[model samples]
Target: MTGTTPTAWQQRIDTLLHALADARRDAAAAQAREVALLAEAVEIAQAMAQDAGGPTSVADIPMRSLAAQIGAAARVSDRTVQKHMSDAVVLVERFPATFATWAAGDISRGHVRVVVDAGVGIDDNAARAVFEDAALEVARRETPGRLKPAARLLATRLHLVPLQERHTAAATKREVWVRDLDDGMAELIAILPAAIAHGIRDRLDQYARRVIDARDTTDTRPTDARRISEVRADVFADLLLTGHASPDVSNDAIPADEAIIARVQVTVPALTAVGADDTPAELIGKGPIDTATALRLAGTATGWDRVLTHPVTGTVLAIDRYRPSDHLKRTLRVRDEHCRFPGCRIPTYRSDIDHTTAREHDGPTELTNLAHLCRRHHTLKHHSAWRVRQTPDGILHWTSPTGRHYPEHPARTLVFTTEQAGADIQTGAVSESATASDPPPS
Candidate 1:
């Protein structure tokens, strides 16, 4: 009976392991099939390009036509199609052995990507072939994470250029990027040289240690103090802006009496701004932030632009700006919050407030007639088949040349009027509909 029970448990464990292995195989098979399809698409694109003029120049390739066809068929964006096409060309033409290995489920798509990324800019086909051979072998034996650094090192060695030269060349590509994350936060990434990057990190760490030491000795703070990471981040920002270790630091070098005005736009509900409500505020470029942080920031604000918005509809009612143009711009900024173009999220402040119906055609300059469009979208609107119309409610309805329709609603603020608050208190239920008919809050 004991032997039978042990055998049964072993069988179940084996079954689960087999299932996971099958899933991995299935995923690999799918990737292989996708690569095959991409290869075919690339062939068709090349054939079309040749038929267009039999031209010798890269510019002669009808990329737009190819991208459009692939995008439509695959239900992907043009940029995505372009990437797929590039990958297809590289896999089928440049790394056939690696492609075969990937198709056979011996290596993952990630492994393939690492190899391809490493092989880029290698003009000599023989050198690329050698690099691919070594990289593929490394990929087959190692995880993608382990293979990437190995592949990169192989590429550098194969390049035949000095390491310092490569480092200098790569340093030119250093950049800073901001990626919006979930939960109203953002990731600010800085790609810099190793020396500079390490220096910055070490400096932040030093400041963080100082903060920890200061809190321990001078303040009766709880054991659950701000984390080392949090302190370091705050210190980094403080040093960058005010040249101080902390915001409260007052010394001969840096005076705490001087105000540090943060130049950031935050759209808060009128009631929340006045402490009547606890509704969250929308930090421009970021998403919704908590009301406490919003209130704290608002309290320290050096200047203010009072924007009155309808409590129910969340529509901009009026802007109290000193300049007429500034008022118009603020009204549009509050109304749009982002570019009105479909799927575009460029902040309204960075976007151009365009007249949907042209001024030459006698379009009014009212909020209803104006639309916020990024520079690229504005040019596309004028030149391409993208048409935009703003409804009375400020919702933008877009019509593509293919007759596809997309609607972009106005950015809504979360604010409850006195009547809506009263309704919630009486019924013990809260909903947007309860406030839909309510007058704007004072």
Candidate 2:
């Protein structure tokens, strides 16, 4: 082979990269344009409703046939099209600035998604304008996963209703439902409060870890090997079905290790912690929780952390998780909010802190060499042809088997603006403003 083969491959890669960029921009623009078309469809439905002397309200748009017609032309699901039409009305009307950004290709459809999800809580047009300006500015630079925290915080700030009040109202809507999956399996879905839900998951995870770790040491012969996920599922089922993790066929009850408890992080502002403010306390990887719930958890918590973060950048300036577990781990958890694999959003609490360089290669157990990786990605890194390196700044530069490079960054990549914190709207102001507005949830 000629020495020019490497040069040829480089040129091909450059071509692919450029094409991918163009395609992404085109796709975003297409999505932006879809909003307008969907808006027009809704308008047509409204006109039909008005002409027939029928209910002309948005919810009563009677878009079943309209959506079906559109769906036929677009070869999409009528139900999905109806849902999109509802969401489109919101984007095109309520968040024109954000829509424009997507149209201009400054961000992707995923960015719009997070913004829309967060925007629904605003319920006021002017407040949403402020939110859009702050969020869109940050959304332009960061990935959708990184944008979520900023978006959520902006949504919380812009709401006129007190978080506790809204949370209480929202809580009323919580219930569990089941959906059928393939192969005679069903997915048990629980729509619970953030704190409770996350706590349940954490507890299951801790139990799963204990079971997996003790597999080799325990004298009892295990039924079958299982991954952490499988163990967690099995434990959940066992607890729900028989009131314990493992049922004793010999009338023996296994001792519960109360010390192996779940630890959930509740990140509240110093003011909020002391009841000086009512701002929502975050459930870390989960979204905001009510102040009452936060206090309850904090009151009973065994450990405490004094985390100092940059107000504007949201950077972790310093943190002390207080637990004897490696301080490096606590710091890494705060820094790497999720797995340091491109596009992966698995929370760091459920992930492994991996050495970017193998420890066998004399990699130090320090910040630069350490980052969180979900078991899937960690296994892929070790078993597949993928390779990764971490920069001192906590960027994970991963090279695929095909030699494609994807750069993963720390979760704090979200940029915060003064508007995100409700500085623009003054007290008792948000509700009074933005009286007239638009849109529907996706």
Q: Pick the candidate with the highest lDDT.
A: 2
Superposed by TM-score, candidate 1 places the C-alpha of residue 421 at a distance from the truth, in angstroms, of 74
Q: How do all models score by TM-score?
A: 0.46, 0.75
| Candidate 2 lDDT (Cα, 0 to 1) | 0.73
Q: What is the lDDT of residue 370 in candidate 2?
A: 91
lDDT of 1 by residue, 1-442 (tens): 4557755765676677678868886788788788888788777877777777654766435676777777888799988887887788778788887888888888888888878877776657877887777777657655565455446644654564544455557778999998999999898899975434644775566456556766766644445378789877776777778776554432122245643322345556565566664444545434334455445555655445666555444556566544344556656766676687765666665578899888998999988899899999999999976788888878778886645576666654212233322223333332221110111111
Model 2 misplaced stretches (Cα beyond 4 Å): 1-7, 48-65, 75-79, 177-187, 209-230, 247-259, 320-328, 346-409, 413-417, 420-442
Residue 294 in model 1: shift from native, Å? 46
Which residue segments of model 1 deviate by more than 4 Å? 1-10, 54-63, 172-189, 198-220, 223-232, 242-244, 247-442
**Model 2 agreement with the true structure over 239-307: per-residue lDDT tens digits:** 788866764321122355444455566666666766666666776655667888877777676555566
